[model samples]
Target: MSIRAIIADDESLMRSGLRLLLGAADDIEIIAEAAHGAEAIDLARELGPDLILMDIRMPVMNGLEATRTLMAQASHPEVLILTAFGTDEFVYQALRSGAAGYILKDTPPDELIHAVRAAANGTRTLSPSAVESLLGRGTTSATGLAGGGDGGAGPLGAGNPHTPDPLEPLTAREREIAEAVAQGMTNAQVARSLFVSTATVKTHLARIFYKLDVSTRVQLALLVNERR
Candidate 1:
Protein backbone atom coordinates (compact mmCIF):
# COMPACT_ATOMS: atom_id res chain seq x y z
CA MET A 1 0.00 0.00 0.00
CA SER A 2 1.18 3.50 -0.75
CA ILE A 3 2.02 5.63 2.27
CA ARG A 4 -0.67 8.30 2.47
CA ALA A 5 0.74 11.65 3.59
CA ILE A 6 -0.21 15.29 4.20
CA ILE A 7 2.05 18.28 3.74
CA ALA A 8 1.70 21.06 6.33
CA ASP A 9 3.52 24.29 5.64
CA ASP A 10 2.70 27.98 5.56
CA GLU A 11 4.53 28.52 2.30
CA SER A 12 2.60 27.47 -0.77
CA LEU A 13 5.78 27.15 -2.75
CA MET A 14 7.37 24.81 -0.27
CA ARG A 15 4.26 22.71 -0.07
CA SER A 16 4.00 22.55 -3.85
CA GLY A 17 7.67 21.60 -4.16
CA LEU A 18 7.25 18.87 -1.58
CA ARG A 19 4.08 17.61 -3.20
CA LEU A 20 5.82 17.38 -6.53
CA LEU A 21 8.89 15.67 -5.15
CA LEU A 22 7.07 13.18 -2.92
CA GLY A 23 4.33 12.56 -5.48
CA ALA A 24 6.95 11.13 -7.82
CA ALA A 25 7.65 8.30 -5.38
CA ASP A 26 5.86 5.10 -6.36
CA ASP A 27 5.01 4.19 -2.77
CA ILE A 28 4.03 7.63 -1.48
CA GLU A 29 0.79 9.52 -2.01
CA ILE A 30 0.08 13.15 -1.16
CA ILE A 31 -3.43 13.03 0.13
CA ALA A 32 -3.78 16.65 1.19
CA GLU A 33 -2.07 19.89 2.13
CA ALA A 34 -2.56 22.19 5.15
CA ALA A 35 -1.58 25.82 5.51
CA HIS A 36 -0.97 25.60 9.23
CA GLY A 37 -0.82 23.23 12.16
CA ALA A 38 -4.51 23.59 13.06
CA GLU A 39 -5.56 22.63 9.56
CA ALA A 40 -3.10 19.78 9.67
CA ILE A 41 -4.63 18.39 12.86
CA ASP A 42 -8.15 18.67 11.49
CA LEU A 43 -7.17 16.97 8.25
CA ALA A 44 -5.39 14.22 10.17
CA ARG A 45 -8.57 13.53 12.09
CA GLU A 46 -10.59 13.41 8.92
CA LEU A 47 -8.18 11.66 6.55
CA GLY A 48 -6.16 9.39 8.83
CA PRO A 49 -3.08 9.48 6.66
CA ASP A 50 -0.18 7.19 7.42
CA LEU A 51 2.23 10.07 7.89
CA ILE A 52 2.50 13.88 7.89
CA LEU A 53 5.36 15.98 6.60
CA MET A 54 5.27 18.89 9.03
CA ASP A 55 7.00 22.22 9.02
CA ILE A 56 8.35 23.72 12.23
CA ARG A 57 7.01 27.24 11.84
CA MET A 58 3.38 27.91 10.95
CA PRO A 59 0.84 30.71 11.50
CA VAL A 60 -1.94 29.26 13.69
CA MET A 61 0.24 26.71 15.47
CA ASN A 62 3.78 25.47 15.18
CA GLY A 63 4.74 21.96 14.25
CA LEU A 64 6.00 21.16 17.74
CA GLU A 65 2.63 21.90 19.30
CA ALA A 66 0.82 20.01 16.56
CA THR A 67 3.13 17.05 16.96
CA ARG A 68 2.56 16.97 20.70
CA THR A 69 -1.18 17.19 20.31
CA LEU A 70 -1.34 14.49 17.62
CA MET A 71 0.89 12.10 19.52
CA ALA A 72 -1.29 12.48 22.59
CA GLN A 73 -4.18 10.99 20.62
CA ALA A 74 -4.81 7.25 21.02
CA SER A 75 -4.50 6.85 17.26
CA HIS A 76 -2.68 9.38 15.12
CA PRO A 77 -0.50 9.66 12.07
CA GLU A 78 3.28 9.57 12.42
CA VAL A 79 4.80 13.09 12.32
CA LEU A 80 8.03 13.73 10.43
CA ILE A 81 9.47 17.23 10.99
CA LEU A 82 10.87 18.84 7.88
CA THR A 83 12.43 22.20 8.61
CA ALA A 84 15.41 24.40 7.84
CA PHE A 85 16.37 24.52 11.50
CA GLY A 86 18.99 22.00 12.64
CA THR A 87 19.79 23.79 15.88
CA ASP A 88 20.05 21.81 19.06
CA GLU A 89 17.01 23.44 20.64
CA PHE A 90 14.78 22.65 17.66
CA VAL A 91 16.02 19.08 17.37
CA TYR A 92 15.58 18.45 21.08
CA GLN A 93 12.14 20.00 21.12
CA ALA A 94 11.04 18.05 18.06
CA LEU A 95 12.11 14.73 19.52
CA ARG A 96 10.65 15.61 22.91
CA SER A 97 7.36 16.37 21.22
CA GLY A 98 7.21 12.74 19.93
CA ALA A 99 8.13 13.35 16.33
CA ALA A 100 8.95 10.14 14.50
CA GLY A 101 11.80 11.78 12.65
CA TYR A 102 13.55 15.14 11.97
CA ILE A 103 15.17 16.19 8.72
CA LEU A 104 16.48 19.48 7.40
CA LYS A 105 14.67 21.08 4.49
CA ASP A 106 17.87 20.95 2.49
CA THR A 107 18.03 17.16 2.76
CA PRO A 108 18.31 15.25 -0.48
CA PRO A 109 14.96 14.13 -1.90
CA ASP A 110 15.97 10.46 -1.79
CA GLU A 111 16.88 10.64 1.90
CA LEU A 112 13.70 12.54 2.71
CA ILE A 113 11.58 9.85 1.06
CA HIS A 114 13.54 7.19 2.93
CA ALA A 115 12.94 9.07 6.18
CA VAL A 116 9.21 9.17 5.54
CA ARG A 117 9.15 5.44 4.81
CA ALA A 118 11.30 4.57 7.81
CA ALA A 119 9.17 6.73 10.07
CA ALA A 120 5.99 5.07 8.85
CA ASN A 121 7.60 1.73 9.65
CA GLY A 122 8.13 2.87 13.25
CA THR A 123 11.79 3.74 12.87
CA ARG A 124 13.31 6.84 14.50
CA THR A 125 14.99 8.79 11.72
CA LEU A 126 17.25 11.84 12.14
CA SER A 127 19.35 13.99 9.92
CA PRO A 128 23.10 13.74 10.51
CA SER A 129 23.10 17.24 12.02
CA ALA A 130 20.16 16.34 14.24
CA VAL A 131 22.05 13.26 15.41
CA GLU A 132 25.02 15.43 16.22
CA SER A 133 22.76 17.78 18.18
CA LEU A 134 21.38 14.82 20.12
CA LEU A 135 24.91 13.60 20.90
CA GLY A 136 25.83 16.67 23.01
CA ARG A 137 28.00 18.20 20.29
CA GLY A 138 25.60 21.15 20.11
CA THR A 139 24.94 24.01 22.53
CA THR A 140 22.35 22.00 24.43
CA SER A 141 23.70 18.90 26.18
CA ALA A 142 22.24 15.50 25.45
CA THR A 143 21.60 15.02 29.17
CA GLY A 144 19.27 18.03 29.20
CA LEU A 145 17.41 16.73 26.17
CA ALA A 146 17.12 13.33 27.87
CA GLY A 147 15.29 14.99 30.79
CA GLY A 148 18.21 14.95 33.17
CA GLY A 149 17.40 16.83 36.37
CA ASP A 150 20.60 16.91 38.38
CA GLY A 151 23.67 18.52 36.76
CA GLY A 152 24.68 16.14 33.94
CA ALA A 153 23.24 12.94 35.40
CA GLY A 154 20.41 11.92 33.06
CA PRO A 155 17.45 9.69 33.82
CA LEU A 156 19.84 6.73 33.78
CA GLY A 157 21.84 8.44 36.54
CA ALA A 158 25.09 8.31 34.59
CA GLY A 159 27.41 10.30 36.87
CA ASN A 160 26.37 8.67 40.12
CA PRO A 161 27.57 5.09 40.34
CA HIS A 162 25.87 4.84 43.73
CA THR A 163 22.53 5.26 41.99
CA PRO A 164 21.45 2.00 40.47
CA ASP A 165 21.83 1.94 36.71
CA PRO A 166 18.48 2.21 34.94
CA LEU A 167 19.61 -0.18 32.21
CA GLU A 168 20.56 -2.89 34.72
CA PRO A 169 17.23 -4.62 34.22
CA LEU A 170 18.04 -5.44 30.58
CA THR A 171 19.53 -8.83 29.69
CA ALA A 172 22.67 -9.21 27.54
CA ARG A 173 20.73 -9.57 24.30
CA GLU A 174 18.37 -6.78 25.21
CA ARG A 175 21.29 -4.48 25.90
CA GLU A 176 22.76 -5.28 22.49
CA ILE A 177 19.47 -4.44 20.85
CA ALA A 178 19.18 -1.18 22.75
CA GLU A 179 22.69 -0.20 21.75
CA ALA A 180 21.96 -0.84 18.09
CA VAL A 181 18.76 1.18 18.32
CA ALA A 182 20.62 4.05 19.95
CA GLN A 183 22.95 4.06 16.98
CA GLY A 184 19.89 4.87 14.83
CA MET A 185 19.71 1.45 13.16
CA THR A 186 16.24 0.54 11.91
CA ASN A 187 14.65 -2.74 12.95
CA ALA A 188 15.57 -4.42 9.68
CA GLN A 189 19.12 -3.12 9.87
CA VAL A 190 19.52 -4.26 13.46
CA ALA A 191 18.06 -7.65 12.63
CA ARG A 192 20.43 -8.06 9.71
CA SER A 193 23.43 -7.10 11.82
CA LEU A 194 22.49 -9.47 14.65
CA PHE A 195 21.44 -12.36 12.39
CA VAL A 196 17.94 -12.22 13.80
CA SER A 197 14.52 -11.80 12.27
CA THR A 198 12.79 -8.42 12.27
CA ALA A 199 10.11 -9.89 14.49
CA THR A 200 12.76 -10.96 16.98
CA VAL A 201 14.29 -7.52 16.92
CA LYS A 202 10.87 -5.97 17.57
CA THR A 203 10.27 -8.35 20.46
CA HIS A 204 13.58 -7.37 22.01
CA LEU A 205 12.79 -3.68 21.46
CA ALA A 206 9.55 -3.97 23.43
CA ARG A 207 11.45 -5.55 26.27
CA ILE A 208 14.13 -2.91 26.01
CA PHE A 209 11.50 -0.14 26.18
CA TYR A 210 9.90 -1.73 29.22
CA LYS A 211 13.21 -2.42 30.90
CA LEU A 212 14.46 1.12 30.33
CA ASP A 213 11.11 2.77 31.08
CA VAL A 214 11.21 4.62 27.77
CA SER A 215 8.31 4.97 25.36
CA THR A 216 10.17 6.25 22.32
CA ARG A 217 13.30 5.24 20.43
CA VAL A 218 14.64 8.80 20.81
CA GLN A 219 14.45 8.41 24.57
CA LEU A 220 16.18 5.06 24.38
CA ALA A 221 18.94 6.61 22.29
CA LEU A 222 19.44 9.42 24.80
CA LEU A 223 19.77 7.01 27.72
CA VAL A 224 22.21 4.78 25.86
CA ASN A 225 24.25 7.81 24.77
CA GLU A 226 24.36 9.06 28.35
CA ARG A 227 25.73 5.70 29.47
CA ARG A 228 28.72 6.02 27.17
Candidate 2:
Protein backbone atom coordinates (compact mmCIF):
# COMPACT_ATOMS: atom_id res chain seq x y z
CA MET A 1 0.00 0.00 0.00
CA SER A 2 1.31 3.45 -0.90
CA ILE A 3 1.63 5.93 1.94
CA ARG A 4 0.10 9.28 1.00
CA ALA A 5 2.06 12.26 2.31
CA ILE A 6 2.05 16.05 2.47
CA ILE A 7 5.40 17.84 2.60
CA ALA A 8 5.34 21.17 4.45
CA ASP A 9 8.27 23.56 4.71
CA ASP A 10 8.87 27.28 4.40
CA GLU A 11 11.49 26.85 1.68
CA SER A 12 10.50 25.79 -1.78
CA LEU A 13 13.89 24.18 -2.24
CA MET A 14 13.39 21.94 0.77
CA ARG A 15 10.01 20.84 -0.48
CA SER A 16 11.48 20.15 -3.88
CA GLY A 17 14.30 18.19 -2.33
CA LEU A 18 11.80 16.07 -0.45
CA ARG A 19 9.76 15.53 -3.58
CA LEU A 20 12.82 14.27 -5.34
CA LEU A 21 13.92 12.07 -2.45
CA LEU A 22 10.65 10.55 -1.27
CA GLY A 23 8.83 10.66 -4.59
CA ALA A 24 11.25 8.06 -5.90
CA ALA A 25 10.33 5.58 -3.21
CA ASP A 26 7.93 2.85 -4.35
CA ASP A 27 5.66 2.92 -1.28
CA ILE A 28 5.25 6.68 -0.85
CA GLU A 29 3.14 9.18 -2.72
CA ILE A 30 3.58 12.94 -2.27
CA ILE A 31 0.04 14.16 -2.52
CA ALA A 32 0.66 17.84 -1.73
CA GLU A 33 3.18 20.47 -0.70
CA ALA A 34 2.71 23.58 1.46
CA ALA A 35 5.00 26.56 1.86
CA HIS A 36 3.67 27.61 5.23
CA GLY A 37 2.00 26.06 8.24
CA ALA A 38 -1.43 27.55 7.44
CA GLU A 39 -1.36 26.18 3.96
CA ALA A 40 -0.19 22.86 5.33
CA ILE A 41 -3.13 22.75 7.68
CA ASP A 42 -5.63 23.52 4.93
CA LEU A 43 -4.13 20.98 2.57
CA ALA A 44 -4.01 18.33 5.27
CA ARG A 45 -7.68 18.84 6.12
CA GLU A 46 -8.59 18.55 2.50
CA LEU A 47 -6.32 15.72 1.32
CA GLY A 48 -6.26 13.67 4.52
CA PRO A 49 -2.85 12.26 3.77
CA ASP A 50 -1.45 9.40 5.84
CA LEU A 51 1.46 11.52 7.06
CA ILE A 52 2.86 15.04 7.03
CA LEU A 53 6.49 16.13 7.04
CA MET A 54 6.38 19.44 8.91
CA ASP A 55 9.04 22.09 9.26
CA ILE A 56 9.09 23.66 12.72
CA ARG A 57 9.74 27.28 11.69
CA MET A 58 7.45 28.83 9.10
CA PRO A 59 5.57 32.02 8.32
CA VAL A 60 1.80 32.57 9.01
CA MET A 61 1.98 29.76 11.57
CA ASN A 62 4.66 27.54 13.02
CA GLY A 63 4.70 23.77 12.57
CA LEU A 64 4.14 23.16 16.29
CA GLU A 65 0.87 25.11 16.33
CA ALA A 66 -0.17 23.66 13.01
CA THR A 67 0.44 20.11 14.26
CA ARG A 68 -1.63 20.79 17.37
CA THR A 69 -4.49 22.08 15.24
CA LEU A 70 -4.30 19.24 12.78
CA MET A 71 -4.11 16.55 15.45
CA ALA A 72 -7.13 17.95 17.29
CA GLN A 73 -9.41 16.36 14.71
CA ALA A 74 -10.84 12.85 15.07
CA SER A 75 -8.92 11.37 12.14
CA HIS A 76 -5.73 13.38 12.06
CA PRO A 77 -2.77 12.09 10.13
CA GLU A 78 0.56 11.67 11.85
CA VAL A 79 2.89 14.71 11.78
CA LEU A 80 6.63 14.20 11.45
CA ILE A 81 8.41 17.36 12.60
CA LEU A 82 11.52 18.54 10.73
CA THR A 83 14.11 21.02 11.93
CA ALA A 84 16.91 22.87 10.16
CA PHE A 85 19.44 22.16 12.89
CA GLY A 86 19.98 18.78 14.41
CA THR A 87 20.52 20.30 17.84
CA ASP A 88 17.25 22.24 17.77
CA GLU A 89 15.22 21.85 20.96
CA PHE A 90 11.85 22.33 19.25
CA VAL A 91 11.55 18.56 18.81
CA TYR A 92 10.62 18.14 22.46
CA GLN A 93 7.72 20.52 22.03
CA ALA A 94 6.54 18.68 18.93
CA LEU A 95 6.62 15.32 20.69
CA ARG A 96 4.82 16.79 23.69
CA SER A 97 2.17 18.19 21.38
CA GLY A 98 1.39 14.75 19.94
CA ALA A 99 3.63 14.68 16.89
CA ALA A 100 4.33 11.13 15.78
CA GLY A 101 7.96 11.51 14.77
CA TYR A 102 10.90 13.91 14.36
CA ILE A 103 13.96 14.24 12.11
CA LEU A 104 16.52 16.92 11.40
CA LYS A 105 16.47 18.79 8.10
CA ASP A 106 19.97 17.60 7.28
CA THR A 107 19.19 13.95 7.91
CA PRO A 108 20.48 11.59 5.27
CA PRO A 109 18.07 11.16 2.38
CA ASP A 110 17.57 7.43 2.97
CA GLU A 111 16.80 7.90 6.68
CA LEU A 112 14.25 10.61 5.97
CA ILE A 113 12.33 8.27 3.72
CA HIS A 114 12.42 5.54 6.35
CA ALA A 115 11.28 7.93 9.07
CA VAL A 116 8.30 9.03 7.00
CA ARG A 117 7.22 5.45 6.40
CA ALA A 118 7.60 4.63 10.08
CA ALA A 119 5.38 7.57 11.09
CA ALA A 120 2.72 6.59 8.56
CA ASN A 121 2.54 3.13 10.09
CA GLY A 122 1.82 4.41 13.65
CA THR A 123 5.38 3.75 14.79
CA ARG A 124 7.40 6.32 16.72
CA THR A 125 10.65 7.65 15.24
CA LEU A 126 13.31 10.05 16.54
CA SER A 127 16.78 10.94 15.30
CA PRO A 128 19.34 9.85 17.87
CA SER A 129 21.19 13.03 17.06
CA ALA A 130 18.08 14.92 18.00
CA VAL A 131 17.95 13.18 21.37
CA GLU A 132 21.62 13.98 21.92
CA SER A 133 20.90 17.56 20.99
CA LEU A 134 18.28 17.86 23.71
CA LEU A 135 20.64 16.23 26.18
CA GLY A 136 23.31 18.78 25.27
CA ARG A 137 21.04 21.60 26.48
CA GLY A 138 22.61 21.19 29.97
CA THR A 139 19.23 21.14 31.69
CA THR A 140 19.49 19.58 35.12
CA SER A 141 16.37 17.60 34.37
CA ALA A 142 18.03 15.73 31.53
CA THR A 143 20.03 13.34 33.66
CA GLY A 144 18.83 14.18 37.18
CA LEU A 145 22.33 13.13 38.22
CA ALA A 146 23.74 16.19 39.87
CA GLY A 147 23.89 16.02 43.66
CA GLY A 148 22.07 14.89 46.77
CA GLY A 149 19.27 13.06 44.98
CA ASP A 150 21.02 9.73 44.34
CA GLY A 151 24.62 10.66 43.56
CA GLY A 152 24.25 8.90 40.23
CA ALA A 153 26.64 10.29 37.69
CA GLY A 154 24.30 9.85 34.72
CA PRO A 155 22.07 7.38 32.90
CA LEU A 156 25.15 5.42 31.94
CA GLY A 157 26.80 3.52 34.74
CA ALA A 158 29.56 5.16 36.78
CA GLY A 159 31.61 4.28 39.83
CA ASN A 160 29.09 6.22 41.96
CA PRO A 161 26.92 3.07 42.45
CA HIS A 162 23.66 5.02 42.56
CA THR A 163 20.17 3.74 41.98
CA PRO A 164 18.48 4.65 38.72
CA ASP A 165 15.30 6.71 38.76
CA PRO A 166 11.90 5.22 38.16
CA LEU A 167 10.31 7.69 35.77
CA GLU A 168 7.09 5.70 36.05
CA PRO A 169 7.18 3.28 38.91
CA LEU A 170 5.62 -0.07 37.96
CA THR A 171 5.16 -3.44 39.53
CA ALA A 172 7.08 -6.46 38.28
CA ARG A 173 4.41 -7.30 35.75
CA GLU A 174 3.98 -3.69 34.71
CA ARG A 175 7.72 -3.40 34.21
CA GLU A 176 7.67 -6.51 32.02
CA ILE A 177 4.88 -5.07 29.93
CA ALA A 178 6.68 -1.74 29.68
CA GLU A 179 9.85 -3.39 28.46
CA ALA A 180 7.87 -5.22 25.81
CA VAL A 181 6.36 -1.90 24.76
CA ALA A 182 9.81 -0.30 24.57
CA GLN A 183 10.82 -3.10 22.27
CA GLY A 184 8.07 -2.05 19.85
CA MET A 185 5.88 -5.03 20.71
CA THR A 186 2.22 -4.62 19.93
CA ASN A 187 -0.43 -5.71 22.45
CA ALA A 188 -0.66 -9.16 20.91
CA GLN A 189 3.08 -9.47 20.81
CA VAL A 190 3.28 -8.43 24.43
CA ALA A 191 0.67 -11.00 25.34
CA ARG A 192 2.60 -13.73 23.56
CA SER A 193 5.80 -12.64 25.23
CA LEU A 194 4.28 -12.69 28.69
CA PHE A 195 2.16 -15.77 28.06
CA VAL A 196 -0.95 -13.78 28.98
CA SER A 197 -4.16 -12.81 27.24
CA THR A 198 -4.18 -9.73 25.01
CA ALA A 199 -7.01 -8.37 27.15
CA THR A 200 -4.78 -8.53 30.19
CA VAL A 201 -2.06 -6.60 28.41
CA LYS A 202 -4.56 -3.95 27.37
CA THR A 203 -5.71 -3.63 30.96
CA HIS A 204 -2.13 -3.15 32.12
CA LEU A 205 -1.47 -0.55 29.47
CA ALA A 206 -4.56 1.44 30.46
CA ARG A 207 -3.39 1.53 34.04
CA ILE A 208 0.17 2.28 32.93
CA PHE A 209 -0.93 5.21 30.81
CA TYR A 210 -2.79 6.69 33.73
CA LYS A 211 0.04 6.05 36.15
CA LEU A 212 2.58 7.61 33.84
CA ASP A 213 0.30 10.55 32.97
CA VAL A 214 0.82 9.89 29.29
CA SER A 215 -1.92 9.81 26.70
CA THR A 216 -0.21 7.63 24.08
CA ARG A 217 2.38 4.92 23.70
CA VAL A 218 4.77 7.44 22.15
CA GLN A 219 4.54 9.59 25.24
CA LEU A 220 4.95 6.52 27.42
CA ALA A 221 8.13 5.58 25.55
CA LEU A 222 9.54 9.08 25.88
CA LEU A 223 8.84 9.31 29.59
CA VAL A 224 10.11 5.80 30.28
CA ASN A 225 13.26 6.22 28.21
CA GLU A 226 14.05 9.46 29.98
CA ARG A 227 14.06 7.62 33.27
CA ARG A 228 16.60 5.15 32.04
Residue-wise C-alpha lDDT for candidate 2, range 94-153, written one tens digit per residue: 776778877887788888888898788766677776656555653213222111111112
Error of 2 at 158 (Å): 14
Misplaced by over 4 Å in model 1 are: 136-176, 185-200, 207-213
What tens-digit string does per-residue lDDT give for candidate 1 at 94-134?
Answer: 88678888899999999999999988876667787786776
Residue 166 of model 2 has an lDDT of 53
> Which regions of candidate 2 fall more than 4 Å away from where they truly are?
137-189, 198-215, 225-228
Root-mean-square deviation of Cα positions for candidate 1 versus the true structure, in angstroms = 6.3
lDDT of 1 at 192: 90
Reference-based lDDT, residue 157, model 1? 28
Residue 225, candidate 1: how far off, in angstroms?
Answer: 2.1
